[model samples]
Target chain A: MAENKIEIRNLYKAFGKKKVLNGVDLDVKKGESLVVIGGSGTGKSVLIKCIQGLLIPDSGSIKIDGVETVETSENIHEKMGMLFQGAALFDSLSVWENVAFVPLGKGKMSKKDAKTEAIRVLRQVGLAPDVADLSPAELSGGMQKRVGLARAIITKPEIIFFDEPTTGLDPIMADVINDLIIESARGLGATTLTITHDMASARKIADRIAMLYHGKIIWIGTVKEMENSDNPYLQQFITGNAQGPIQVEV
Target chain B: MLKKTLGTFLQTLGKAPLAFIINLGYFTQFVAKSVYNCFMPPFYFRLFGMQFLNIGFYSLPVVGLTTLFAGMVIAIQTYSGISEYGAESVVASVVLISVTRELAPVLSALMVAGRIGAAMAAEIGTMRVTEQIDALITLSANPFRYLIAPRIWAAIIVMPLLVLFGDIIGIFGGYLVGVYKLDFNPANYITNTMDFMKSTDIIMGMVKAGVFGFIISVMGCYHGYRSKGGAQGVGEATTNAVVTASILILIANYLITELFFAR
Candidate 1:
């Protein structure tokens, strides 16, 4: 079995009166893809944010490369990349600049070299060289997602997170993004964690799938295993049934 | 029933001061952190330069036009009243002192509070709601260093220069009204203006300008950085930035005046 690249144990996080993550225990092996499936407001984003050190958990342990990362994640941040649900590109910079922001900001590469490198990465993501100079706003939704993917992979991080990378996209574009995610992660051999409610996306990208319900991981298994699992919540979720243990707030 | 009603009333009354204290503490911590980071290494000189141009160079016309009209009004008003007392020369001195020591600094700072402060809030607030700030963190960029510090330093450094420009323009406006409109001897008006003008007055206005600049940028950045919800949240932050900055400028103006000229 591969060694774990990321380990989360007994994670707990809550807002004022609502517990978002209740003792979530998850792990992803080195160079593996793990997708967490949950309904809206079920703390999927919060779980990833805790790992990214964007939100402080109420109690838990998150280890990356065997080092505890709850207190300080600055060093850990260098080994990780994320694609936000909104494709949160810096509007102030050009597309190439956004792609090369990390290297350019760190002064690790000259502007000319960074631009060349950014264009190369953009090409790998299926963007034309002409798209390099345009702003993030000028691109279509699909293109912005590609630019965001390019940015996440440009540094060749050890781990990458995709937060609803397929949300707000057409079915074809969503599939295209799924293919790109596979290609990029496979190319880097990076550990990947993705959170989404899209079952097709989950099945397409996940080596193992976990179901989060009411702040807990109710079930986790391989895609084939998920199909045969008898857990009622998991069964109801995967089937997209309205009659189930889970109740829609609306 | 009466006791419960009184308890609820007291609780409601107490909440305001508690919230005020909490907000003040946050604002203080934010300002202190940003100021400390402003002097740290790996400075973003490019961002600072852009902010300097935006806050300083772009603010010239509004400052110029405002002070010019204010100075003309002072000259006309002072001339009419002082002429009744057969003391027309006091109009020159009054225009010089008031424009330099009070009007230019306050009015220019207020104008900039409306323009730059609101812009800082709206821009950063939008970035916040869209999760761009979180993205920057993942990308290893500190928001304070990359965003707040440049703005704070630019507003502080550029403000006194703006006030100096305002002083010259304002005094000239008074001169225009005094000599051309009032038919006073141009040479006498110039002489009277220079004679009444003390370096202390100009120095005082510059000092006030610098303080006002700090207040404006801090309020704008603080509100924007903390803003949440979405578009409506950004809108609220913009309005709060302008209002708080304007109010603080006025308060600081009085405090600085008392500091410099208290008898």
Candidate 2:
């Protein structure tokens, strides 16, 4: 059994009267790629935010290497990097500046050195060095995502979170992102927690899959077990059925 | 029916003050945090330099033009109005007092609130909605230090300088109108303006500019930081920043004037 690098227990969060994460509990082992699958508005992103310490849970415990996160210092974030859903590149910054933001802002490197390192990381993410000085607004959706990926991995954090990694991309671009995610995680040997409803990406990348339904991880297993599972909700979600125990609000 | 109507009216009336107090408390806390972060370490000089350019250097032309026109208008009006009693010479003194003590700082701040304040709100609001602000947090950078403090500091430092320029241009405008347009002797007009000027007048205007600058930047950051929804929300924050900053500048102008000049 692999050692658990992340442990979440009884996480509860609510916005107004709507309870988003009712009692989410899950764990990801060391160096494991855990992809959380859920329907829209099923609290998958909220779950990721809770783990990232962006949104504080109303009640719960989130532990990273057994250190409780809630109300703790911001030191935990230093060990983690996240790729936001929209890429969220700073529009004011150039491609290289956005990628080198953390290092430059932290005063860890000179501007020239940071620019050099940024170009190297951008190249690692399959971008050319020529694209370095262009602003984020000048890039296409696919290129922006690549730049965001470069920014996320530039710090070489021990743990990485990918929020809706392939959102708003064409199928070919989505596949390319999936391949890059797998390659990057492997290269870093980092524990990764990716939240997305994209089954193809999940199947291609996840060492273990967890399905969040009504804010709970109701199913957890290998990709094959997920495909062969007898659970009705999991089956309905995987099959994309309209008539299932998980009712669509629409 | 009468009792129900009265009860509803009373409840509505009671809720307004309660909401006002609650909002005031939250705004106070936000300002407290921003001030605390301003004095803390890890200051971003690059961001500060960019804001100075945006708020101070870029605003120079508009502020200069506005004050110039303001001084010219005051000279013409005061000369025409007071000339009936054969007191056109008082025009120089009036223009100097009005521009240095009141018109320059207030008008310049209002212009900046419209320009820099709205832009700050919209830019920060977009960042909030798009999750760039969250990205900063995950990168372990305090948003206040990286984003808010630099803007506030730039506004404070740059405002007085802008107002000082506005005063110079304003006085020059009066000089043009008095000597060239109004047929007053250039030396007499210059001496009258000089004799009437006091250091306290310019100092008071600079003090008001500094306060107005703080208010404008704070409103922009507050509204933008709390913005939600999407594009519509950001638009609303931009509008609110300008409107609130303008109103606050007027109110603060009166209060500061009272503090300086009240008998």
DockQ of each: 0.91, 0.85
Fraction of real interface contacts that model 1 preserves: 0.90
Q: Where's the lowest-lDDT run of ten residues in candidate 2 chain B?
A: B80-89
TM-score for model 1? 0.97
Residue-pair clashes per candidate, as listed? Answer: 0, 0
Per-residue alpha-carbon lDDT of candidate 1 for residues A1-250, written as tens digits (9 for 90 to 100) = 8999989999999998999999999998999999999999999999999999999999989998878897564578899999999999999999999999999999989999999999999999999999999999999999999999999999999999999999999999999999999999999999999999999999999999999999999999999999999999999999999999999889
lDDT at position A239, candidate 1: 97
Look at candidate 1 and tell me the lDDT of residue A215. Answer: 96
Error of 2 at B193 (Å): 0.3
Residue A214 lDDT (model 1): 93
Name the regions of candidate 1 deviating beyond 4 angstroms: A72-74, B1-7, B84-87
Predicted structure with the largest TM-score when compared to the true one:
1
lDDT of 2: 0.93
User: Looking at candidate 1, what is the lDDT of residue B24?
Assistant: 94
lDDT of 1 by residue, B75-122 (tens): 999987764453347878888999999999999999999999999999
Off by over 4 Å in 2: B1-22, B84-86
> What is residue A241's positional error in candidate 1, in angstroms?
1.6
